[model samples]
Target chain A: MTPKKVIIADKMNQFSDHWNPRVIGELNGQQVRAVKLKGEFVWHDHDHEDELFLVIKGILKMEFRDRTETIYPGEFIIVPRKTEHRPVADEEVELLLFEPASTVNTGNVVDERTRTTLQKI
Target chain B: MTPKKVIIADKMNQFSDHWNPRVIGELNGQQVRAVKLKGEFVWHDHDHEDELFLVIKGILKMEFRDRTETIYPGEFIIVPRKTEHRPVADEEVELLLFEPASTVNTGNVVDERTRTTLQKI
Candidate 1:
């Protein structure tokens, strides 16, 4: 395979949709995805996979069952498996997400916000 | 465990050694490490692990057998397993590396620069 670099900022400009993650790269059964977030996401939890959220731009407020954590740009948070959490952003936030291939966006609870098929950007 | 966010910039400030990777986080047997790069790295290839290099600051050039890929800030490149490559940087570059926990920096060729024990930041 030809070695190619994935430019995150260029990928972020390809789409303007919120909460939908675009596949950027994959390795070791894990995938690196980019997502644009605004407003609030559904309260959910991945029972079998852990999710790593890296804020590329803007601030991200992750609300959990007990407390809320503010993730700034250049910061990352690892949401353990089976931990119910919600991600909220006041403005458009660009982020990179890392998780296994079988991980579902909405976790066990399937909703309209769940993205079953992710597009590669 | 208290949920804590890993700030990439803050972690980058904790060390100044070049080519030595410091563990930042781990998930599913894979580790997220931060490395400061300058000059050129040795030509090596991991036999069983694929390495992902995300340029957090400055520029990185990965030289392969056939080509050289330029990875800029906010860009990432995945060096496939068994692919002989060397990373070169003109100046100090901050990068985030993702790979299996057992992955060695020197790949198949063991040298004095090879670090057996990695420090956690």
Candidate 2:
């Protein structure tokens, strides 16, 4: 098997599109993805999957029904399964997402922003 | 449910022992752990699981049978299952480990340095 060492900064430079996640590495059944987030995302919930978001660059605001959490660089937030949440960013934010291989970007609601097939960077 | 957002740096500060892993968060079946590594570790292989090592504070050298990979902060390496590898750090190094809940720190080796029960910080 080939060796896999991912330089997070190098992978972030591979893509410039916002909200599109590019797979960086995979361990067990989970996929490690890097995404650029700007503006706001739709409110959705993953019925059976939990998503972990680790901020690498800018600030990320995860808005829930009751409250909002601000995640800075070197910080991570996990959105539990079946919980409705929306992610927003005032500026461009680089994030590393850890989730299962079967996760969809839009979760329960799949529209134009939904990315079913994620590209590996 | 309560919000779970982990500040990697803060969680890392809670531990001081080298080679011992502290759990930070859990997603799906995998547990995200933080460990401080110094000196040389035992050469072992996970026969049934793959482990991801993400450098957080210092340089970490992963020595394999064929070659050695140096992982710096903001970088990560994935050691495939059944691959013989040993980790070493010249000075104090902080690392974030991503692996299954049942994964043992020493892998196939059960030595005194092995941490069977990882504490959560």
Candidate 3:
């Protein structure tokens, strides 16, 4: 691929929907995606891949079956494979996520929020 | 792992030095590291894996053998494996890097700017 810069904010503005992610780049067989989030997300887990959350704007509250954590801008969290979790936000949030190309944002479960058209940036 | 926040600013403050990266998390055997950069970095490349550079703040200009691109705070770039490149910044910039845990920041070529102890955040 050509040597190019992936302008994040510019990429984010290309789409106006929430939950649906836009694929920005990939390396080592893994994909990097950016998504806009709101309210709460479905609780689920990927049986074979971990989920990485890099908060870009606003605050993200990701909760597991027992405990929960808040991820702010410049902060990141890794939800290992097979670990169930739900991501929530009291307000709107923007984020960058890293995981296998096939990973469903909603994990093993499916819902209206489980989007698959996330194109590579 | 417990559900907890990885406050990047707090983590960044934990270290007062420069060049060295702090590992915040990892998934699927790849590590996620954060580093502060200014001026320029040694020209180098990893022979085995691609290099990912995500600009968190300020601007990043990466020059390759043929072309160069500017990556801003919301942008990212992936330098394919074995692609020689140099990172330059007119001012200080904060960034996040994703590569194999064993991949050195300076690629295969070592220099004074290379850092080895980037601990896990």
Q: What is the C-alpha lDDT of each candidate?
A: 0.91, 0.92, 0.83
What TM-score does structure 1 among the candidates reach?
0.97
- Which scores higher on TM-score, 1 or 3? 1
User: Against the true two-chain complex, what DockQ does each candidate achieve?
Assistant: 0.75, 0.78, 0.69
The residue pairs found clashing in candidate 3 are: A6-B75, A8-B74, A8-B75, A23-A120, A23-A121, A24-A121, B23-B121
Task: Supply the global lDDT for candidate 3.
Answer: 0.83
> Whole-model lDDT, candidate 2?
0.92
Candidate 2 structure quality by residue, lDDT tens digits, B1-121: 7486898888877868898899999989999999999999999999999999999988999999888899899999999899999999999999999999999999899999988898877
**Best candidate (score: TM-score):** 2
Best by lDDT: 2
State how far residue A27 of model 2 sits from its true place (Å).
1.2
Best of the candidates, DockQ: 2
Candidate 2 vs 3: which has more lDDT: 2
A22-104 per-residue lDDT for model 2 (tens digits) = 99999898999999999999999999999999999999999999989999999999898999999999999999999999999
Clashing pairs in model 1, backbone N/Cα/C closer than 3 A: none
lDDT of 1 by residue, B1-121 (tens): 5378998989999999898999999887889999999999999999999899999999999999888999898889998898999999999999999999999899998887898789987
| Chain A agreement with the truth for model 1, given as TM-score | 0.96
After superposing the true interface residues, what Cα RMSD does each candidate give? 1.1, 1.2, 1.3
Tell me the tens digit of each residue's lDDT in model 3 across B1-121: 6656677667666765667888877888798888887887888998888878888778888988788888887678899998899899888888888887878888888888777766775
What's the residue-level lDDT of A81 in candidate 2?
94
Candidate 2 Cα outliers beyond 4 Å, as residue runs:
none
Query: Fnat of the models, one by one?
Result: 0.65, 0.74, 0.72
